[model samples]
Target: MRDLYEVLQIGREASAEEIKKAYRKLARRFHPDVNPHDPEAERKFREIQEAYAVLSDDDKRSQYDRFGTVDEGESAARQAHARWAGGRSRVNVSFGGFGGFPDLGDLFGDLFRGGGPVSQAPETPAEAAVELDFVDAMRGTAVVVALRREVECEACRGSGHTSEKVCGRCRGSGRLIHTDRVRVRIPAGVADGDRVRAAVRTTPGGEVAVAVKVRPHPFFERRGDDIHTTVPISFAEAYLGAEIEVGTIWGPVRAKIPPGTQSGQRFRLRGKGVRSVRTGIPGDHFYAVQIAVPRVVTPGGRDLVRRVGELYGVDPRSGLPLGLT
Candidate 1:
């Protein structure tokens, strides 16, 4: 009977990860299906399995390592030695004198003698997501995100075989680790809040993703393809005909006001709004005229206003039909 560590072929202080790694490697090689009818291979495989069953279970390992048995004065080692060396390999071993293991002869008779192979489970793949700044999303920028992914083993092309394995630099795992920078293009005239979807740049399993963010612009208020903003005008500018320089989403442009223009007047700058990414067509910008009225009135100004009022007549609302619902 060998020490459990020797049977598992790991250092006594080996971490669980190390233990698992060793176990996987050994199991792959010694699995009954792979080995067929080699008696030594069968025995070694059973020993590996038994060792893992104990060590992988913390409580069992702790008890076996500490008191040599769980909750008792006697040791499992003593009974186990007696059962094996005593030529009574079918004897039962108890835990805290509670439950007993049926003899290896009856319980795992075929297993120890040589049993059929066990099935292997398939593995699951991984996916990743990423975010970007406004400008990046609009103009498209390349970013590095730490992706946790498992590629097929290059050695076995994920088959786990050495000679037949693909380059593990890729992993027998089919996909190769990307070491080069990739290019991601962003379209022009993209708004502050929008998404840029891209396919897998150059990798297996086309990765679908969105670059979420906005791009920057100094003078643009986007509304569909139209932009909206206010333009200021002096009282005289609104009352008399004038062509004033107005600021639009694209830049400063000239806008004309008709005679007797009032405040809150709307003017459109055609083909000057946000450009459509799909259509590549420019939209329109609407200008709202704000009249700058004098907060304080001078004597001359008052006289002039009075004269205009007399000329225009006092009953400005005379023609209204107010009560009509």
Candidate 2:
């Protein structure tokens, strides 16, 4: 994987403003809308999004700087487990500590030699997938998910045997699987595939990682933190300057449609896009102007259009070259 800083074309010690500036420049240049049908540009755009997703956040950026990764979900899970272990949990599952577990080689050797009963492996982290609306993801929300976790058998005290006989409660496995409902807090501006961690109260040192999936919006499209949309303007509105209501993720806002505004012309609304979940800074919204033409024209309307056309002294395409360059 490319370094986040390298992906953003900035130095490792670049300030937040510099990073944001670089990201915006690159994003506009390689945006999918601007470079349609170009797979390479699309790939670069995704890379930009991923890099900014991590580097934009202080905690994730710090972790990436140290460990070369942004495993915030795993880190949060481990911390939650630590807190749970400190309380009433008798069995603690340590991830990377000296007191966690026996050496793998020795444990395997003992298992082959039949030296004694082998210890149970730590339970795998549970996963729960949650779907969110585009606006919901931009605004953050809490969701409840059902998680199935493995709990130690209370009948045998996690020994798998009682009085030299296999425990019937756990079927000699020393573990019991149970389902519990866990509520996870989803942060704002989370893109698809982002994960959030929640603790499993029923199991010792157990956690559930919630994977986020955002549904596509009908009109609003997201590109990183910014929002993009096309607003259609009537011919009169395009010819005569007017204040039109533009739809945004937040709501409709009045925007000016300047006189002589051409189709495909883009306008930006500052601080009207999504607010970053990490930095709390809002992004800008971009809207392209599309001139809507009338399907049917009356005789009087045709005369009016001809009169309007007379205002342009020269042909619109007079500058175009007929031959290929």
Candidate 3:
């Protein structure tokens, strides 16, 4: 059985980030979530998790570095991390104290090995959020934005130090070395709240540009070459015949209603929807009419009904069995 160190291919001396990074990479590659029925992947995932558990803890790391057993794979990786203790110290010694002081070499060795330190903090990327409405998304829009980022220090040029105040650890190389890039494009006809990713890219100085969040719009919804809207028409306009105006992205347009039009009748306003950002040909807008009914009838309304009733008397239910009886 391979131990955790072997699974991640790292030594006990690995830092927290190193340990976590290696573990995650292996876990994702072998995770059952991505690999459905592969026995090898499942076993590998378990081994990596166990290794991460031990190496991720500092106490376990110290113990493993000393009494570690020989696993063909883990043994090699552990040695590479400098967890073992066998290196020659460059210290010079003399039989007795020199003319006025101890040998400078021995003093330097003690001070350098026991006290001198070297390491640096890597620069992380900047992040932000952007918003796009449905109309903006469907038509495609460019936006300019401002961001407060961790830029290089003008004095030290981000080396984190100056001749007078430079960081002894980094020697003024303001950034660590790593490079990655990501890019994203917004597609046409994307609905509100849809996401467009921006690819990460590395600068000459090694900085990460993360994706900004894109916001959603409330007013518009997009479909290919079609826009939809609800139109309300009064019952009188629908039943007695009249002209009704429909709202579109461009403007309001009149859609004629023939006599005795029914509720839920759809009216199509061609060439009034979203215009193509490329070709510029406009799409169509479809209006679905809902008839609005009045709440109460007046006495004059009763007279109108009576007169209309006189026009078509006998039996209003002519097709029913009651009419036949």
Which model scores highest in lDDT?
Answer: 2
What's the count of clashing pairs in each model shown?
A: 24, 0, 11
Of the two candidates 1 and 2, the one with more favorable TM-score, higher being better, is 2
lDDT of 2 by residue, 266-308 (tens): 9999989878654567778999999888899899999999998
Q: Quick one: ranking by lDDT, best first?
A: 2, 1, 3
Candidate 2 to truth, TM: 0.60
Candidate 1 worst ten-residue window by lDDT: 93-102
User: Candidate 3, TM-score vs. the true structure?
Assistant: 0.40
Tell me how candidate 1 scores on lDDT. 0.53
Pairs clashing in candidate 2? Answer: none
**TM values, all candidates:** 0.42, 0.60, 0.40
Against the unseen true structure, what C-alpha lDDT does each candidate score?
Answer: 0.53, 0.70, 0.52
Residues 146-177 of candidate 3 have per-residue lDDT tens digits of 33334444656666787777755555767443
Instruction: State in Å the error of residue 57, model 2.
Output: 22
Q: Ten-residue segment with the worst summed lDDT in candidate 3?
A: 84-93
Compared with the true structure, the alpha-carbon lDDT of candidate 3 equals: 0.52
Q: Whole-model lDDT for model 2 versus the true structure?
A: 0.70
